[model samples]
Target: MTRASRFRSLALAAVCLVLFSVLGYAVTGDRAPLDSFDVEGRNLEDWADDSRAFIDVLRVVEHLFATVGMTVLTVVLVLGLLLRRQRWAALLALVVMVATSLSTSALKVWLGRDRPEWQGTDFSPLSSYSFPSGHASSTAAYACLLVTLLVLFVRRASLRRLGIVLVVAWWLLVCLDRVLLGRHYPTDVIAGSLLGIGIFALGLALVDPRPRSTAAHAEPLPEVYASERRVAVILNPIKVEDVGQFRSVVSAMARESGWSEPTWQYTTVEDPGTGMAEKAAVSGADLVIVCGGDGTVREVCAELAGTGIPVGIIPAGTGNLLARNLDVPLYLRSAIDVALNGQDRAIDLVRVGGDGIEDTHFMVMAGMGFDAAIMEGVNEDIKKKIGWVAYVVSGLRSLMFPAIKVEIQVDDGEPTTHRARTVVVGNVGFLQAGMPLLPDATLDDGILDVVIIHPRQFLSWITVAMRVLRKSPIVDETLDRRTGSRVRIKASTDTPRQLDGDSVGEGRELWMECIHGRLLVRVPR
Candidate 1:
């Protein structure tokens, strides 16, 4: 049968299983469950208990395999990326398998709310009150998943039959194991098995169960703990360097506020703090805070663009561009306290693209030409020694240099050509170390603040220098100060650009836009 046809069949089967589990639970949840068979037949309870010995071993395997539901699903997807083959059948099978198993678990918990007479410490391992056994459900799901895979992916009938035989045996044993161990009644095991079977059938309804490629193999990690609510922090210890102090303060504050001790994860430059933050999101972090300079904040911000988790920033870098804009306290104590007590505020992020493809999310501003030029020139050592003074030295050097000509367009608006020293696009106006770059830029505001500087004589250059140094807004008849949601600029000439203070590859044509009201921050109320 075609994979789609098979998937459709599997889906129907899964629906039947869910209906069976639900209707089955609603009718049988309060009854004796299986004692009627013992009363009608011979003394089979003892016999059934002994039958669980082999079933327990199979139970372990069933749990292990079932836990990898999502991993297996991903394997099916990534396999398609790596190889082109009849893989959808295999994908369909696993999908049904996982769906049924999850449904069965949910049903078990839902029914378990009402305690049955058979429930006690003897069945403690089979937790969540249990109307249908998760093990039995998993056994049924994986049995069907494996059989479907073999039938659809394997060319040889012998191999398919062998897989089918093994799966059916394990599935049966897993169910029998639960029954014999007294962990579940016969009805519970039977219901779970049926649900698994149904989900497997649903997969047949969705896609074919065939191994499309070697890449389809997935190794799921071991689950360490069980908690519905959790948080993970991936940061540079150097950024939060006084870990001893930071922890003590956060712990005390959290204790006072009724929050548990937060998990701390360190991220290296090699792995990038942003990637670690993404892992944190997948692992179920409710709120994430980053402690670093503009680059670290920007990197993590890129990953968290649409996650809706308010990112708390503890600025430790020399520039602290975003930190400055947000009015985040620079000292370690204030930063930590702000993270603990700050209210969540949403902000806009600017994206700049051009050249050999520089993709960056900027919280402070995007700069082209002189500002970008000076940014590239200043080294970390200079910044550490002289702080924002390094920018002054480089800015002066850049001011003396030739002007960069560029075409500036704003959100499908008219394109204007200009000769400038530098162009700045601000999301939240700020420069280095708590210095406000755009005085009127607000975090909650929905518009981007744009500034363009035109080159001039030495006297004019000095005026620009004084204007920037004295923190002038720099709006004039010639300079561009426009507000728009989307801004497009093409390099009339090749120019260097810096985003959120980090220098990216130069680009001539670029589209910069605000991902409006998307950032969530933990700021004080």
Candidate 2:
């Protein structure tokens, strides 16, 4: 461990010591448990009867596993980080596990209070300690550790806020469980929680912080906008029925942000996200804000590939998956706000083709199965009737759609064949809410996520729907995953294609390859 790690560990240990010491001496006067000393406590039998359930559950877990749940949770987090190659994540997990264990063990042991024995229950084993619950300690410690890791690594500010909410919720649930299970008094659990948090924070203070990758430098001089910085707002006017309306909004937003009038581009179904982005580059726009839906973003992103012109999103089309995934504000105002002030995040884009032959780039995903078919079939008439829920009604309409034959060649992986409805390729997870459609999908690491869904029945459609809605990995006995820096997809027939949300006309045989990460995005800090 480095100096930071050592100090962090010691800090946690020190906080634990101080809190335990104060609680040991000031509160409850360090009383021993009734069972340990054979001391008679008022209402001892009642307390014993109430805590029976909690002890039983703990005993069950102990019987099945030698150690408590802390180690298992630690393993889970460690394995996740390990698989993801997130070294910092592993260290943070270790810190949380240690902090939780130490606080739980030391706090109660030092209290020297006797366990409550209401009935003929065996309080014989642990009678002396009572004030603090090991369960509460473990719960608080585990949850706090998890939250700490999220806070340290997760990029989106709103998501970090959500993680904070989730951690607090976990704490509440754990506290309630302990009280209802009669394991500890509400006050005891509360104290244990405080100790857990302190210990974790102390632990955190020790680990060396990763050098800020995009730390803000000196504040900029007060100016409406960087006059030197040129901007081009590329848009897919064809996305909405009225490009005129979307244009008015984009033009106004650009001027308000003190940016030069942007050169507008409308992508046609014939030539979606391609060429147009390159057009932005040629124009020398310092910043490129894409105002259409996911398809337009993908196109703009494709062209912005290699060029460091920071891209922004003004999501207008259906299924703003990338925008949702990036946590770009849904409302135009919030989107514009972030477009103007948000931290710029660099995300990977998959260029699915070799040097010239019919190549495509995607920011959300790329697949060739039922999902692809849905994207191809979705029409504006249906989309206008319903926003994203169109997937449900449209999906039902697409049940009769036949599967197409395709050959997939993953990097260094064997070619696999699948007869499916549509192959949906993804760069980010949420196909709809932009929730993480792929839990494993990270915007930074340069790799494409290929989801192969083999839904055999109507029930299968439900399963896919659930997968998209949940924004989690949908793995089953039948689901296959192919991950690589590049992928080549060849279809026997001209299958329907869509990038982002807009349809990318049909193609008979096409190849898809990943660009190995290279997209500049304008985001908030």
Candidate 3:
């Protein structure tokens, strides 16, 4: 979700709530027709009203699913989502519940509409402003949010439709109970229900406005020559100490699988893996396996883009962003098995270019400013010792980096100017520590997701962190996002930059283009 769309959704919901609250106050006053209709409906249902058993059941139901009860239920559900790493859905659910409850309270006090007078229906009395029914709004919000989640996740069409119907029916029953028990007028419940629906729609726009990918299955792989195909491995020697042992396992596995002897290219500190990958590809390798960190993979991928040979990954780095996106196993043996037997899937690769550097390709992400600082400042020895924890230390030291003014242009659109602490463009969703900076990003989507941060003060990092954790689309001056196939950025000063975690020095400008499905990757069948 972009910043503009998020702002517009919230504004529209606020307008709808205000309009409904005003309409309820203007029409549902003393001696109003809605009050007469409520009394007449009670009169028509005299037998059901006099049934002590039905009344007791409804009273118990209302007490159990009331505002307090629903709050508890929402907390439990949100906590579960967080624990499961479903942060976006949890934030949406939490926002809807809190906004619905708070709005109901504020509107009730503002309108000050009174409850229906129960003469002889055995309806218990309660004293409170009742312009909009709190029970009706709370239940309606839960129902609407549930329907949204069901539509997004439930695959069976019949099940989705049935779940929505059941939820709506339950909400209507709650509203009816509110009116029948003389706790609220019909118009009050109607307005409250509308408010709930409005909030729900807003939440959807904030968190899930983009249409989900609808492919039922991954693309089928082409035929592989099991008998004659040649396998080539680009191995980073420093990444593994037992090089002879690793080669023995590879050779044994290759022999057992009916493939020829594996061709090997050892990577050097000066030439990570790109030159070796080129050599292997030119030597007629059928499949090229990369065994190292993100930088090595990026180098190999850049060298082999559009060559039609599938690249397999053995994740031996701190942040295996591309491997995680491809669902490749992290263990060495499992990764080798996947590389040999897995299916090939086409994925997008990003081409980046800027001042003072040759064009390069990155399969994961590119960033400027604060993100680059975090990468550049990492202690190499610490990274080798403790893996990804080195990044945390660097990130903490770089939080107070100064924001810079930049002009950003998306595709053919006019350039938009802003001050930002960092700018990131990604082809995949998750980050090193599993934070989904771009929740809706897909590997083969043929576009890039851009996020910009501009927190005004160090204290505001808390707010920014919360928004990221929630995956909230709402943005003020502190955060914004955009998506496009081509992005051009020019900063006021030469800022630090990085591509797929490799430092690229400071540059004043960057131009990136998404190369759609330009590379093939091996993924588990």
TM-score of each: 0.53, 0.51, 0.58
Clashes of 2: 49
lDDT by residue (tens digit), candidate 2, 1-525 = 457767766777687757755655645764434233232232433454556686576455433332345577678878877664456557766776676676566656766655544323453344446567666666666676667666654433455677788877866765654444344555566667766666666656665333222213324325445545667766666544456765676667567656677677777778765777788788777787777767667767877878877888877766677777776755555576567555677787776643223666667765554555676666766565545657766666777566677777777788777766666566675555333446676677776677666667767767765765665454653355667766677777777665565555676544555555487786645
Backbone clash total for model 3 is 0
- Give the TM-score (vs. native) of candidate 3: 0.58
Ranking by lDDT: 3, 1, 2
Clashes found in each candidate (C-alpha, N, C closer than 3 A): 27, 49, 0
Best of the candidates, lDDT: 3
lDDT of each: 0.64, 0.63, 0.81
Residues forming the 10-long window of minimal summed lDDT in candidate 3: 209-218
Candidate that would win on TM-score: 3
What lDDT, from 0 to 1, does candidate 1 have? Answer: 0.64
lDDT of 3 by residue, 222-301 (tens): 56544367999999877764789889877776676555899999999889998998999899998898988899999998
Quote the positional error of residue 322 for candidate 1 in Å.
1.6
Q: On residues 1-525, what C-alpha lDDT tens digit does candidate 1 reach at each position? A: 565676678667867667775646454545555557523212333454455555456456545554475356446644652353334644564465557656876776666633233432333554455566677776676566666555533333344576688879867866665555455656666667777677666556545343322211223223355444344555666544366776676566555544466777776868557777888788777667787777888878778878976687877776776776666655454565566556667788777677777566777788788778988888767665545668888877776556777777877789888877778888876555334446567766777777887747767765664675566755773355777888876776678888877787577766777777877876644
User: Candidate 3: where is the Cα deviation over 4 Å?
Assistant: 1-227
List the candidates ranked by TM-score, beginning with the highest.
3, 1, 2
Rate residue 307 of model 2 by lDDT.
83
- Superior candidate under TM-score, 1 versus 3: 3
